[model samples]
Structures are given as C-alpha cells and as structure tokens.
Target: MLQSIRSASQHWLGKIVLSVIFTFLIAGVAIFGVEEFFRGGSSSTVVTVGKTPISAEEVRTAYQNQLQRYQAQMKRTLTPDQARAMGLERQVLAQLVTEAALDQKTTDLGLAVSDAAVLRAIQDEPSFKNANGTFDRTLFYQTLQRAGLNEPMFVREQRSVIARLQLADSIVSELPVPQAVREAVHRYSTERRAAAVLSLAPSAAGEIPAPTDEELTAYYDNNKASYRAPEYRSLNLLVLEPEALAKPEEVTEEDARTAYQANQSRFGKPERRTIQQISFPDEAAAKEARARIESGEEPFEAVAAARGLDPKQLDLGTLAKSELFDPAVGNAAFALEQGKVSEPVKGRFGTVLLRVTAIEPGSIKPFEEVKDEVRKEVALRRVRESGFDKAQDAIEDARAAAKPLAEIAKERGLTLATIPAVDAQGNDPSGQSVTGIPDKETTLPAAFRADVGNDTEALRTKSGGAIWYDVVKIDPSREKTLAEVRDAVVQGWTKAETDRRLVAKSKELTERLEKGEAIETLAQETGLPLKEVTEIGRSQSKDDLSPEIVERIFTTPVGKAASAPSGDGRAVFRVTAATMPAFVPGTTTDGQLVNSLRTALADDVLGEFISEVQKSAGVKVNQTAFRRALGGEY
Candidate 1:
C-alpha cells in the first residue's frame, strides 16, 4: 500500500525536525541564519521549524560542520568523495531535519530563555572561573569571541539553547512509565519460549536451479537500484603530513647539541620563591590586618583567624616565578634574600605581606642527562626537512612532466591508489562502508575533489600527514550500458513479481474475510502460521511492531482485520479474539524472570515524538546550485 499523503501542516513540520533532531534545534536555527545567502538558487529546505526556513544550505553547512568536527576530533582528514560516500552529507541533512522540527515545536509552544539567564549561566560556569573564583567578564567575552560568538549573539543564542532544553525537559518529564505498566513490560521482556530447533540451509539444497532469463529479468527490474554501480571517482592528491617529512633516527650528536643550545631558554629552570598573604572581606580590614602584622605582636595566623579570615585562602604558594599571579609579586618574592620579610603590598584581590621562606636558584639539566630527548627532537626536525625537500622535488617533477600519474608515482616510490566514487552530492558509492584501501585516510586526500572545479592541471594538495596523490582519471556519472546492468535488472524484476503475487494473495484473503472467512482457516489455507500472541499489550509488541506498525495495530478496531504486505512479500497480521489474555501470577522461576524482564523493557521505549515542519513549508533544493556549490559541473 502507498504511504498516506501527509498533506497536513503539522505532519510536514514534523518531518523537518526529524532531520536534525540531534544537535537539538540550535543547529537548525543557525542553519536558518545563513540559508538564504547561497548564490544561484537556494537548496531545498528539508524542514522548517516555525516560519524560520531550514534550507538545503542549512543542512549542508551543518553536515559539513559536523563532518569537520568529527575529522578534527578523530584527527583524520576526509577526501571530498570519501565524505560523500560515507553519506556524511545525507546523514547530516537528516539530522538537520530533526532539528528543524524540534525548533518548530519550540516556537509553537513559545518556549524561550531570557538573555539575562544566558548571561548568568555563562558567568556561573566553572570553566569561565578566573583566579579570584568569580566569572571574569573579560575572559568570558574573550572566550566567546574565540568561539566565533560575540557577547550579544552568544547570549542570544545561548538563551535559545536553554529554552530548547526546557522544552526537551518538559517532554521527558511528562513521559512517565507507570509502575504497573513497567512491571508488565518487564515480564514480557523476560518471557522465554521453548522451541524445537530446525535449520533449512540453502547449501543443503545442492546446485539451486539457475534462474530463468525471465526470472532474472524480473528480479533485476525490481531491484535495479541495488545492482546499479555506485558513482566512482579516481583522483590525484597532494598531502603534507608532519610525520611523513620527519624521522626519529636521523639526529646526530652535533645536531642534538646545536638544537639544545639554540633553544636553551626554553629548557632553563623556573625561578622559585616563597610569599605570604593577608586576605579580608574588605580592603579596610585587610589594611588593618597588615598594620597589626607590621606592628609585630600579632602572629600572621592569629591575626588572620581573629579577623575571621582564612589564612590559606588567598595565599600564593611557594611557587616558581612562572606560577606567580602578578609580575610585581613575582619580582618582590624573588628579590628578597632567604628569611627576609617584605613590606605589605597591595594586589589585585587584597593586601599581601610577603616573606621569603627559602630560595631555590634556577638551573638547566646537564647536557648528558637531556641528550637523548634533544636527539629525538633534532632527528624529527631533520626528517621533516628532508621530507619537505623530497615532497617539493616530487611536486616539481609532477608539475614539469606530461607523464601519467602512475608512472610519476612509481618513479617517486609512492603507491598509486584509486579513490572510491563520490556522487555529485559528494556521497560515496559504497554508502558509508568503512572498508577500503589504506582504510579511507591514507587513500583519500583532504583536497581530493573529483570535479577539480574546471581546473585541468593536477595540483599538489596536503592532507593530514605526508600522503600525496596525483589525479589519474576523473570518471563522471553516466548511463551504464545494458550489459553492465543486465544482472541488476533481472533481480529487480524478480522482486517486483514476488511483490505482485503477494499483493494479489493479500487482496484475495481480504475479500474472503469480508465474506465471513475465519482467520484460523485463512492461516491454514496459506502456509503462514498463526502467531499465538498471549497477554500482549500495545507496548509489549514493540519488538513485533516498530513504532510505525504498533501505531497501525492500535488504530485498528479489535475485530477488524489489519494486514500489510511487508518487505520481501511477507504479510503481517493482528488477530482479535473473543477472549483476552489474563495475567498469571508467578508459578516458576521463568515466570518471575519474565515479569522482571517486562519492566526493564518498558524503560527502554518511552517518549518519542516528531514534527515535520519542512514538508509543510514546501522547501525545494536546487540540485544544480548544490552541485555548483560543491565545485562540480553537474
């Protein structure tokens, strides 16, 4: 049966949110920000959350950002084609759709966070806490700036993020699994069945008949998509990885010595000192405490405690100059000789009285002690230099030669490898399979673009490490010859035939049922066994019916028939009987286990809601524009 045409505005809105439900709605909102700016025509919006449109640009940007983040986190680089093959693009856009829906929901409900709340949240964050244990406004501003968000925009965005969180919380909090329901679910989950095992192996039936040309053709026609070869790209790339140019074993004693000597300041010892502090709630109290300490009878600890001050609270430890809070404090502490007490000094937080407890002079490690470490650094540097020289030579040669890429690679002792095909969308032919030569990274260059953007000349490109590539061949997507797709066409035809037969059978059964045929008799007539589902509730049928199937079953009246031709010509069913299953108290260990199992199972499936806002908005992607944006002449 065809899926119901979801023409309702709510249903379409839900679809948009379905795309980017993960980054939450914030990503969708951000996508909403720059989506309209794309040149040519805007990419279709998969979803829209509210009146805010989420275009293809939004999904694409979000996807690219997500991919880049993933690459950076994994410390790997992806070729343009490799990224597409992995369906990083589609998956990313899908997530954006989810986000778009959530965003719409948020808007519909009028959920919002205030700017002040966002500011407070930022100020309260421990990461922004400065030495004084308070949110340093400057640091907070600077950090936001570093994150590419100015104060106002960050606060505004953060407010929205918090609002979205509130909405999520409301959704989650209201989703309660009742105790009785949970227990019942647990029982079903723990329920075990006894069965006589049987195996029907295809191998046991030796030499299965060769499919007739008609059967093959039918199968191929039915499953043509599966058999069509995926888009493939052959690319040449240039890469510059630090490891490729540097080797650890190339440092000489002289090189090590020279390296260590030239950078001796970096290896020098930190100057150490001791200091004391007198902290107070107010500067007046701190000044008075200092005065008493200077006047001599009051011990620093006693005076501090009498003033209800914590002596260790504000004290800078006996630390190296590099560790000191202020340059003045460091200078004064280091200047004092051993056992000398210094005058009271005013500092950032409070007045401080300093005393030099002991002086530890700075010293560098002996050359012999650090020789090994120095040698490693020197050797690595040499390797990098040598590698760069070699890479430069290769680039020069490639640039000068009209020779084939394979020959150039062979001459330079580099292996030539082919990259998997990427579609105009930059998706891989394999659809995100992790299997490949050199495991994707070594084989794919960061700049391995198949389109080459109208540039005919092969240019040097650098990726994560020293791996370099030369574009050998660029194969554009083209209609395959019948010979190439004959097998696929046959498979598709077979599947289609199977489906047609199943549909006819289902229709015949439905007509018989309408004519007063019983379900048991129908089951016997067909080979499908009746599934004896006892004491089953709508929730317990989660495994049997995914959310989609479960919803359909519940919507059907108890006595009404509900059957759908599922995948591979399989038909599904739900039988309504005069007698409902009654709960049986625990009679054995297995029964008790079943009860516990049901409860645990109930905990697993709860609170799933979606809104598709994009379809409602009638978003359309300009495929031509998208390909152009991808630097491809589609």
Candidate 2:
C-alpha cells in the first residue's frame, strides 16, 4: 500500500491529486516562527504580488521558521549572519513570493474551490487524527491557533492554495519521457562494478610510542573543537530499580519451604525413555504389520523400510515423559514394555508402533539442598512487590512536607545518590560517566530540563522500578584545561604521528608502483597481504577501505595510482579493470523508470509555471521588514 502511494506520488495523475490535497492541508504549519515573532500586530506590507498583500508579520514569521528548520536539519544553531550566508532568508522570500504569485493567478483566473473539497482535505489530515485515527475537531482548532491563524483565516488560505494547485496540475500533468531515456536511467542506477583494494591501515605502522608534552599540546591546540564540552547538570537520583530494592537477608526458612512446596513440579524431573516406531497410514495396515512381526514373517526394520522410512526417521531418541506435549503420544509411549514392539496405537499426527530401548528414572533433591536458592527468589519477589508502593508513598509525603531527597531517603530507607556534574553525553569534567544511574537516556535528558527544587515524574524502568531524579545544579559549559584532557591529547598526538608515518609509507609504495614495481611485490616487501574484491558495485560497502577509497577506484585512471585517507592512515589504489554495463533493451519495466522521469519533468514544469507567474505579476518587497527580520530596526 505504501509502495503504491509512493509510486502514485511519482506518477502524473497521483502527483496532481496529492499536490492539491497536500497544499490544501498544509497552510500555516510550514510557517517557521510565528509564536516567536508574531507577538504584536504590524500594518506594513512586506511583499505585494500583483494585488495580493503579504504582511510584514508573515515575512518575519516565515523567515524565522526557515531559520529554525535549517538549524534542526543541520543539528546546530545558526546566527543571523550565518543564516544569511546559507541564503535561508533569500530562500524564504522566494517561497513567499512564488506562493503569493500563484495566489494572484488563481484570483485572476477566478478559480472556484468547493467548500466540501477544502473540508474533506482538512478532515483527512493525519495531524488532526486522534488515538483512534479519526479527525478530532478540537486538535484541528488548537493546531491552527498555535500557528497564529483562526479557522476561517486558515481555511481561506487553504482555498487559495487548492485553486493554485489545480491550475498548476492541469498544465503539468501527463508529462512523458521516451523509452530510450528511461532505459538509460535504469542502466545507470543498476550497473555494477568491481575493484581490488589494498588497504594501508595505521596498524601497518605497528604500536605507536607515547607523544611528548610539546607534541600533545600542539595536537590539542589544533583540535580544540573536538574537545569542546557539552552543557552539564548536577542531579540527585532516587534509585528504585529491582537491583537497588532487593535485599537478600529478608527471606526466612518458612518462606523458602512454602515456595518450594508450591512449585515442586518445576524442581524435579520425570522418568524418560528412548523410543522408536514405524507409522502406518491406517489401523488395518498397522495391525497387519504387528501381526507379521509377532509371527516372525516380517522384521520391524523391514516393515519400516517397506514404508520408505529412513534409519534416522525410525529413531525417536530419548525424551522426558513431559517432553511429549501431546497426552495421547505420552500415554502410549509409557505403556510400552522395554525392548518389545507394541500394537499400533492412535496418536495426534497418525497411528504409531512403540518400542522402548532404555528408561532413565527420575529423582528429586531434598528441600534443604535448594533452600538457599528458594530463599533468594522469595526475597526478590517480596522486594519487587513492595518497592514501588514504598517509594511512591515516601515521594508524595516528602512533596507534602517540603523535604529534600537526602532527608526522605534517611526516613524511608531509600538510597539517595548525587552526581556532581555530568555533560549531556553523560560524562563529567574528567570524561568519566556518572555511573549507578538506571535508564541514563531517560534520566539525563529529564535532569537537564529540570531546575533545582522542581520535582520530576517517575520513569519506569524495564524492570519494575521507577527511576526518579531532581536537578541539583547546572554547570555551564567551558573549555577544558590541558591537565583535564591530557590522556585524550596524548592519544590524538600518537594517532597523528602514526597517520603521518603511514602516509609516507603509502607514498613510497605508490612511487615504487609508478616505477613499474608490482603491488604483489610491494605487499611482500611491507609484510601485508594483498586483497582482491571482484564485481563490487559502487553501492558495495567495505569495512577495510573507506568510502573515499571505493569512489577513488572508480574515478582513478586504470594505471595511475590514487591515494585516500584510510582509518587514520592512507590507502593507495589503481583501477585494474572498469566495465560499464550496456543499456540492455527489454529488461524489467514495472513503470518505475517512467515514474521517476515523469516526476522530474512534472516538477520542472510546476517550477517554471510558478516562476512565470512571479515574473508576470512582479513582487514588491519592503526593505524595512527584511532588515527587522535580520536583527535590524524598522
């Protein structure tokens, strides 16, 4: 279903329908930072496309939205200057102008979108879906309200977008690509290639000696960004996991004996037998075979062989009485005498003959023998049952009394531990983790968000215990001193030196190859094994060689050596062979190539249509609004 939907979006008809629906549904949610910038009203217009007006408020909101989206995608915050450098503001402006132009064209053409179409599109939106997957009116209103648009205003915007999409789709739908063009695309995407790789890893240089103080300092200075510290918070943890709550000494002799008696079947094994049999198709056939065996006319093996059963099939092997889950099979096997063939008996799968070769009798250990194990299990169960209730009660009481975690722990027998300071990555200033905390991923994020004295909700662990914590303090991020990260500095220095040596070694080998020396001879000289990989496509991933090396092999001239950094070292390569598959006619064609080609053409047409509209109805921009969005006064 998903594949069809995806393919439909790529296909011409599906594209038109999906585009209309998509544009109608998503109106203001794509607007970046309305809550951040739309704090007050403004009368100024930022852009005027033909007769349509886009207010300064809209531009600011859109620009901020664009900034935030970029920041999220890049996973880093950007300053106003950095955003401008990335052309974020320009991209947002282009989008707004294009949309406004389309809206103007829709108005000029007098395109009419039915109220029912708009309503249906809105109702079908997944964002408005409730837990039962039906549209919830309350969520619809709330979502629009959050984006700073009332229901009427948002619906009006959607109506315009829908009309524009209808006009655009009519112009761009059914764009076609030639069969030869599609074949070319398929050949390029599916073609495979092979390479022979000789990886020169840092290990080839052997063990690296320790760096001196000067070398370490230089390495640290060059790579301070790698050592930059993350924001850290100090926290007080309330450990409520089963491992923390369980007490071994709580169980007594009486408890152990009671537990043992209740679950005795789990402790001791039952008598077992190694049995064999020949299955027959019917009662008459099995009875006939039994009679013949009894009269010595037909051997049991001969009967089984006549039925086309192998020796392994005839041997059922040793199994405990309880191991046979079917009651009929177990009953029949147990009733048979040792070394004697029994009469055909009815079972679940078919009729069966039985012979018990050996019987291993069962035995049970005395209560005293497993008492300690039973006592531990009983103690763990008791603690698990009581721990959560005890912790929750104490936490509530502490909240009511306005008492600290340390005080409550003393009063309620809870273990209270404090982490002085740990980064978001869960490491302290010395780069050691704040250990002994259960559910670190859950607890640490919650701790960072919490302020001192703010109570946190209980996070249940996989085990039946709640991990509770409170933020005690926040330690602002700062650059680490040389002494704090000396070990890391030394390690970096050693790696740099090793990589340098390896690169020099690789350069020597490449130079030798250039002088007509074979790679096999070079491998022998360097005491490294030469490896070859055949028919490796560009998509084939290699653990020994980095992606750069694989790409280099394809691009490198067949005889000329190319080098790339490989795992702190370097790899030298020369392409021995290259083959590009011919575009074969009549390969599989399931509309995939046509879909991709149509999608590309349709996109270009839509883009050109929007641009033509923008050109025909020129956009007027307000410089004041642009500067204000870029941290300037209006």
Candidate 3:
C-alpha cells in the first residue's frame, strides 16, 4: 500500500533498505562492451543479471518516478532532451541492473522471507489499522487497491524487499570503525589557527595602463563565447487565475441568498458555555458533594481542593454543546444558569455535578447584513469549482480550431501578455530582468524548450492557475561583433591585466615575508593596513578573511607566508600560531562524528560487497531495450 510505503520510508530500517537499494541502483556500474549489447534485436527485457530478467516496464516505471522527483526538487518540468542530457536514462538503467544483480545474488544464496513474516510486516503497518488500533481487513484491501496492487502482488513484493534487506544487513550491519579513524577526523575538524593578514586592494597593482586596440581585439577573440548572445524566444502567454476571473458583479441576489442559506454554519457561531464538572464513583457521591456545597459547608472549589484537584484540573475551559463528549453532562451544564451548579447527572464516564460560569449566546448574520460578502464568496467559489474549467475548455477548443492564442484571449476577455524577447534565464537581450511572466520558474524553461508553431502542454501555476504559451519567434544565438562589445572587452582586458600584476606583486611581497621581513615593516612600507586574526577554525571565515583565505592559512606552516585571491584583489597572510584542541571523549559532538564515520565505513563495505556480487553473477544490458524504455531510439 502507498501509505505503508510512505510510513516505512520514515523508519530507520526502512531508510537502510531504501538506501541500499538506491545505492546499488545508481552507483554507475562499469559495463564492458556496451556497444555490442546494442547489436542484438529488440526485446522487452532491458537487462539480465544471472538467471533474472529486468523488464522494460519496470525500468520505465522507475525512470518516471525518478523524473517526477527531479522535477519536484527543481520546481520545473524538464524536456526530454534535457532529461537525456542529465543522464537520467543511463542512471535509471544502471540502477535497475544493479538491483537485479542483487536480487539474483539473494536468490542464489537461498535468502527468502516466509509468508507469515510478510503477513506480519503488513499487519504491523500503522496505515492499515483502524481507529481502535487493530488491523482492518477492509482498510488493508482498499489501500492495496488504491496503490494498484493485489494481495498476492503486494505479498510477493514485500518478500523481495525483506530478502534484499537481509542480504544488505548481513554485509553492512555491525561494521566497526577504528578508534584511530575517529581521532583523525576529530583532529581535522577541531584544529584552529591564528594568522597575520594584509589585504591588497586593486590600487596595489598601481594603475593598469589602457589596453591597445589590438590587445582588446585579441582578448575579445579569445573570449568570444562570453560575448555571444544566448538563444531567445518571443512568446504570447495567456494566464487564467480563478480570483482574477471571478466577477462579483455578475452574481445575482438569488444566488447570494441561496449560498448563504446553504452555508449557514459559515455565517453563524454556535452558543458556547464555560463549564466545569467533578466526576464521582457513583450518583450517591455526586449528590452528597452537591448537598454539601448547597448547605454552604463547602464551596465547589473547596470540595475540589479536598479531593486534591487543582483549579486547572477542575476547569474544562470554554466549549460548545457538541464539544462535550457526554450528552447528559452537556445538557445539564447548558441548562444551569450562570454561577449555578446542577444536581447529580449521569454521564458517559460516571455521575457528575455540572456548573456554568459564563454563557455566550450564538448569533447569525441576516442575509441582508452579509449580502456583498456572500456574493463575493459565491462568485469566487463558482470560478474555482467550474468556471475556470469551462473557460479552459473553450480556450482549448479554439486552439484545436487553429485560432491564435492572442486572438482567443482577446475574444474571451483575458489578458494576453507578449514577451518581446527572453532567454532561458528570463533575461532580455540587454541583460535586464524581464517581469510579469507568470510562474516564471516553470514557464521559462518550457518556453525555451518548445519550438515555434508547436503544440505544447499548458503549464500549471502554484496558485492553481494555468498558463498557455505560444512561441512566436526564436532568435538564434550568435557571436557579437568586436565593435558592439568594445567597452566590455576593454573592461575585461583591464581586469585581467590588473590580476596578473597583482599576483606578481603579491608573490614578490610573500617571498620577502617568508624570508625574514616583518609583516608590520612590510605593511608600513606598502602603506597597507595589517590586522591579526585569532582563533580561526578550519570551518570558519571572518569578515576580512574569506573561506579560501582561511583554507590557505591552515595549509601554511607557522612562520610562513601564503597568498590567495580576495575580493577584487589579493591577500598575503602569515601563519602566527596553530592549535589543536584537546579531544574530549563521550561528548555529543564526539559521538555524532564517530557515528558519521561508522556510517561512511559501512557504506564503503556495502559498495564493495555489491560490486563483488555483480562481478560474480555477471551483468548484461540490452542497450536497445533500455533506450526504448525511455522513449528514445538507440
């Protein structure tokens, strides 16, 4: 069942099972003579591992799930070409092949789950339980039906999954990590250092002379790709949102009244009372307590206090009549006047005396009082429920009839937005950000992928809207003339020259500091400000020191100088001190680091085990079948 699968995915055992399966499936197993595998005739089987065959349908299903996951993560739809370029098809095939190899190995080893064990696993699943916490046969069957599985199929799949898990656990569970390994990791993560740093600004390079026309032209030629334009598409988009389409003015009085009458609960509040009660073992005890309160020998609070119940324990807060679990107690509580206590009443749990401290009478707004609000609600609901679908159908009909999107939008009183030109990143030719594109993250990618005059599916927006777009024209990418980008070329040439000079200058200064020159003396001579940074960790970066500089500092030995590129300049740093903090045992941090190392070690062992299994069993792929599974030609 889908619910059971989801619930299992969150458990530790389930995570391990899934991790092992996916690890083998997508580990990029080396295939020998791949081209020869494509020479065979087409078959429904995509791969064969030992005696087991992996069907193309299985690969197709796995690929589609993988594709949907990727789309969800990226929040955008990918075209077929994009998917292929991302090597999704190859990954999917490799995953299935590896899984099949493992399954074959499990079979050879005589690993199997008993039918009783499979039944127990299904019965133990929380998703199949009823309200009383017992497994429900109807719920179990219904869940399997929704998941498109029969009892036999589900039981078989469960058996296979458990067998695979057993194989993986035998290889990876209880694997030990060495104490030295934990110490090494801790030292690397906890080491700290101090450094003397001097920042070199662009001015330190000292005025890069203007480039010659020839030099600029040479730079432009070398970096022509940087100055080239990206392909752009001009699109006509028609977006329909329910809220925007809803016309409150069109809603009649009759319609508003009908909606108001149909949804009375939405326009009114039920009467509520602040009540409290004290339960007794029997009706006699409840009556005795009420009699004592009535005789003024003890108040309700005193009586509750005598029973060792606090005010909070006695108070049930405010509630409507339907909120009370016991109808007898609810009726008695509501019938009592404010500041009055009722006689003993038999409730579902036991006999109880009820008290009402406050009452709030329910009220409903008249139709005339909420006419406009009701009308707006009805209009929006209509558009959301049915109007949007009808409008989409009409637009689709027009599109099927070969009518242009812009004309159809105009005829339907919808806004037709025309993007003059936009690139894959939603940027115009001038590199300015384009605005007003609905669902830009999903739409732009789909638009750039579609060809002019092609029928493309409408994209759905996050706000429950649909966007239909037509590619009007596509501008092919081309190299810009040198004259057209002269300014950018000159700027690039200057920055490159400046960086070269800065590197040389920093190298010269670094050598002097490393030899014998004091950092303060060099700072005074260069007229650059110098600062000392202390307690810099391997993972930390300061405002003046970037992560790269921090890494350089750690790599440099004490009393040595290193240079790294900084923001628009360079920084020469000298290591002044290095410290390795004492590693405390049994701390939370130490435990976490040890556990992570253990997990990594286990993964390595598991990977090696699977690799050996694949080698022993022998794996073969039918490249033609694999390609066909992805709807592609070999």
Candidate 4:
C-alpha cells in the first residue's frame, strides 16, 4: 500500500500540489500578478486542460503576482533580468494549468458548488467583514477594485476556487489504509533496539606526524581554487543612533522614579486571585448556598453541581484586581483567605456566592534595584521619539553638498572610522567581521550600490538614525599568495590527513570486533569513549550519542558489527538485541497511533489520485503564447 501511494505521487503535478503549493497558498498567499493582460486585449490560450482554456492573460497575472511576492519577501527589488532568472514564469504557468485541470475534472464529476455555498465562502472570508462581523458590500467591491478585479471576474474566480476545494476534499476523504499497513506502522513506531558502541574521536587518529614538503606543496596546488580571497572594499563610516546619542548623565533619579510610577504595569502587577462562583436568582438562595458551604454541609463544587453549573463553567481562573466584572463580588472575594467562602454579595449579574482557591501576592521592584536601567530606558525613549534629530541634520548637510562623510563627522561631533579591507559580507581577511562598520542589514546593500570613489546618500536605519558611507577602495577577489595563508593551508591539510587516518583506524577496530573482541574490552584497549544503550526506541534521540549511530545499530542484524560516520570520524557499534512489540487491537493508544499513520498514508494516496486525474484529462501548453505572456522566449 505504501509503495503504491509512493508510485502514484511521483509526478511533478503531485509534488507541486502536495508539497509546494499547499504551503505557498496558506502562508505566502499566491496572487495573480499578470492581471494587466486580462483587462485590455484578448490573447492566445497559454494552456489547455481538457476543454477549458487557461488564457495568456491569467498566466501573465500569476507571473506578476509571483514577482511582487518575491520582491516583498526578499526586501529587495528585482531587476527585469533577475525576475526572468528565477523561472517564476514557468512555475506560475504550471500552477495555473494544475488548477484548470482540477477544475475541469471536478466539473466533469458534477462536483459543482451551489450559489449559496459560494455566498457563504465569500462572507466567511474575514477580509469581507466589517467591524460588525458581517459582510459589507461596499468593502467587498472596493477591495476587489483595488485588486484590479471586477465583481464578475472575482465571483468567477471564487466559484472556481470553492469547486476545486470540493474536489480535493473528496479525494482526501476516499483513500484508506489497510489493516496490515496500520499494524506494520505501529510496530515500526514502538520497536526498540540495544547496542554497545565504540566511539572513535579525532584523537584516535594518533598524533599524525608532520607532512613532507612534497605532500604539502601538492595539497596546496590541488586546492588553490578554494584558497582564493574574497572581493573586499575599504569603507569610511559615519553613524548616529538613538541609544548612542542618549547620555547617561542626562537622566536623573527624578526621571526614573516618574517613569516607574507611571508605567507600573511594566515593573509589577497587583495581586491576582483564582476564584469560582455560582450565580443565584435571589439574595436568599445565594445566602443559603454560602451558609451550606460554611457549615461543611456541602463543598463549593457540590453546591455548584446542585445548581446545574459545571466546575469548569464556574471557574474564572486567575484574574487581577481590575479584571472582575462585579466590584462587589471582587472586593468580598479578595478579602477572604484561600479555602474560605465569601458571604453572598450582590453583583451586576445577580447575588453571587464566591470562594477564593488561590492568590498570587503583588510586589514591586525596589527603587535601587531598577534605578540605573529605568533611567537609561527613559533617556533612550526620549531620544528615539525626537527622530534622532542630530543624525538627520548632519546627514542632510552631507547629501546636499556631496561632501565626504568623514568631514561631516567632524562638523557634527560624530565619530568616523575606517574599516580596512573587508569582503562584501563584511568579513575581513581573517574571516572575522570588520569592526566599526554600520549594522549589516542597512549597510551591505547600500555599500554595494555606492560608487567606488563617491560617498553614498544617507541611508535610514531601524533606530530612526541615518548613516553615510564611502567606498574608499575595491580589491577584486583572487587567489592569495602561498605566503599569505600558509598557516590556514597547513591547518586545512593537517585536518584532512587526520580524518583519513581516523577512517583507517575505525576500519581496523571494526575488524577486531567482528573477530570476537568484546566492544567494551576494545574500548579500554584503544582509549575511546565507550558506552552501551539498551531498550531505546528507534525514534528516541540522544544529545550525547549521534543519531546516525543509533540508526545504524537498528539496521544491523544481531551480533553484526557496523560503522557509522560522526563529525570527528565514526561510531563502530555492535547490535546485541532487538524487538518489535506486537500490535494490539482496539486499545485507545494503539488506535490513535494507527489513525496518525493512516492520515499520512491518505495524503500520499490523495496526491497520487490527483496526478492520475490530471494525466487522464490531458494537459497541453502553447509555447509561443506562454513565452509572450511571460515576456521571454524559453
């Protein structure tokens, strides 16, 4: 059954529908980008799914939507060339063809959505709701208008969408996993294995002696391409940030006290109580219930149950002083100690009988404990609210005059620093980040755009400050001279030789184990970190033991030796025991496990089912029309 599902879903359409588009539609919101074509002239059909034509206009809209989505997600505008490079045009066209094919198949199967169902689907869309929580006709039309869609076009699209969903639901609902498959999955999930593992660390490689000059020279020559230095630029930076401008001395004790007093919610909260109560029709009945609890004739829960109120229905959980709806009941309840019953108190709802189950005492941070932090927060907020005026002023002056940023720094009382040769990623030759450069989020793109000899226009930063930079020098990337990276090259060569030796050592150890040498005895002889694991389920993961070793232990037969690769070298393990728990029928735990496995099996089957439908219906694409709509020849 699993193999059949796997075979069915191997098609491209199945992969796109099950793995890719489902996520794209849910989170990324795939839109129709190339909608402009639909408004003007009639174009050639780009694809045909059965008798339905997916016009060039629809394909164009999808491509445009995809382009805008990419730009928004990446936070960088794509040039026309970049957009073409992504192959989004083909991806979007194929998606539209899949939708058309599904719609065609659903229509042939008579799975049409009724008019009322379409109305419900549209109104249920939270986008069409107003503050009143009902569909607003004005908003409905205005939103579609903003989307470059008319009522007719949008309604048609929604109709197709709802019908396609109906088709998908039927496919998912029809597939079922066999009983044997379910049992097989249960045994796979619950089975455990035991093994003793001999860990081979880099130390096991045994202090590999220094390499010969000929070997070192050959290693460097063969790997020269990987030794090239990245392209780097020298930069002069001028920056202003809100936190940097906030002087600690400017903040006084009075300011911190005032901030702490005004923003009490941030520092501490009042005491909260968890309470339960039952409303009564009259004061007499409420008083009677409270009296019964006070006399121990009945507990609060007993009284609540007698009144047809469930414990959960009566529980209000924990709430702060101001959260209560009735001040009379709240004041009375807060005054009572835990396990004490409050007297009947008249509230907005009715006469209520209340009991406090628990209380969390309120407390405030001592002034001295928070003084320094409070003062700094107040001063920084004040500076940020002013929009970092000093930085803005200095940046405007530099941009208007096109003067070097370093000169502007002196005039504005700001610090200016030069970052020696650093790569486009802001890493210096040593591969550490270049210090004193502006934050990478704002600087990397701007630095790339700036002319080599000219200062950039002031770029806005998240701190509401501005930064200016100049590209002082550009060094094209190239292979570094051997003298420049001799240490790094030697380090790399040593590590590679060590790994090779480790593999050989691990193989030798495996051979000994296969020859009846106990793993624990071998560990003491070789000085490796030795350990044993028993009765651990296949799905269990361990931090100390590598998952690769656990997997290999389960796959190897009892008494057989196997080796699995680790970060340093390898784990040579011998399986001692294994077991598969028999699948018991009708138990709730077993049923739940079987159901979970069936859900996955159903999805695989459904994906295969959809692909078969698409193929049987037949899909064709018009190369010329598709190329024209996408604005390219593929």
The candidate that achieves the highest lDDT relative to the unseen native structure: 3
Candidate 4 segments whose C-alpha is farther than 4 A from its true place: 1-20, 23-166, 183-207, 240-264, 271-308, 321-401, 411-413, 424-426, 437-442, 445-468, 508-545, 554-559, 566-576, 584-590, 605-634
lDDT of 2 by residue, 1-634 (tens): 1112132223355464445333322432132233422222233766677788787667777777666666666554554545655556656665676667788888898889999998986787676665334678877787776666788877887677568668877887678788778767776566555455567767887788887778788888888877777787888887765655666677777878899988665678767899887878898999999899889999888988998888778877798776774467678888888888888888755687877889988776779988877877787787778765785776777767877778877876878888888888788877787797776765676677778878666665545566667788877767878887887788778877887888888788888877888878877777766677556557456656677777777677776776788666677765676666666545555276677678777766675566567667865666665567556832
Please name the candidate that would achieve the greatest TM-score relative to the true structure: 3
lDDT of 3 by residue, 1-634 (tens): 2323644545444465455556654545444345633444338887777788888888888788788878887766766767777778767776676667778988998998888888888888787775334578878898888777898887877787778778887877777777787788888888888889999999999978899888988899899999998998999999988887888999999999899998765778978899877778898888899999999989999888876777887877798887776688888988899988899998655677888889999888889999989988889999999899998888888889999998998898889999999999999999999998998878997898789999988777777788999999999999999989889889999999999998998999999997999999999999987999998988687756887899898889899999999989999989999988787777898888877876777666776776677777767677778788778843
Candidate 1 has its poorest 10 consecutive residues by lDDT at: 1-10
Best of the two (3, 4) by TM-score: 3
- Candidate 3: segments with Cα more than 4 A from true spot: 1-13, 24-47, 54-99, 123-146, 242-390, 455-457, 583-589, 618-634
For each candidate, how many residue pairs have backbone atoms clashing (under 3 Å)?
Answer: 83, 2, 1, 7
Cand. 1 TM to true fold: 0.49
- Tens digit per residue, CA lDDT, model 4, 509-535: 889989998998888887898778788
lDDT of 1 by residue, 585-621 (tens): 4556436555454333322321134433444432333
Clashing pairs in 2: 32-65, 194-536
lDDT winner between 3 and 4, please give it: 3
Give residue 366's lDDT in candidate 1 (0 to 100): 70
Candidate order by lDDT, highest to lowest? 3, 4, 2, 1
Query: Which regions of candidate 2 deviate over 4 angstroms?
Result: 1-104, 112-165, 176-187, 224-231, 236-418, 428-471, 478-484, 542-545, 584-591, 607-634
Candidate numbers sorted by TM-score from highest down: 3, 4, 2, 1
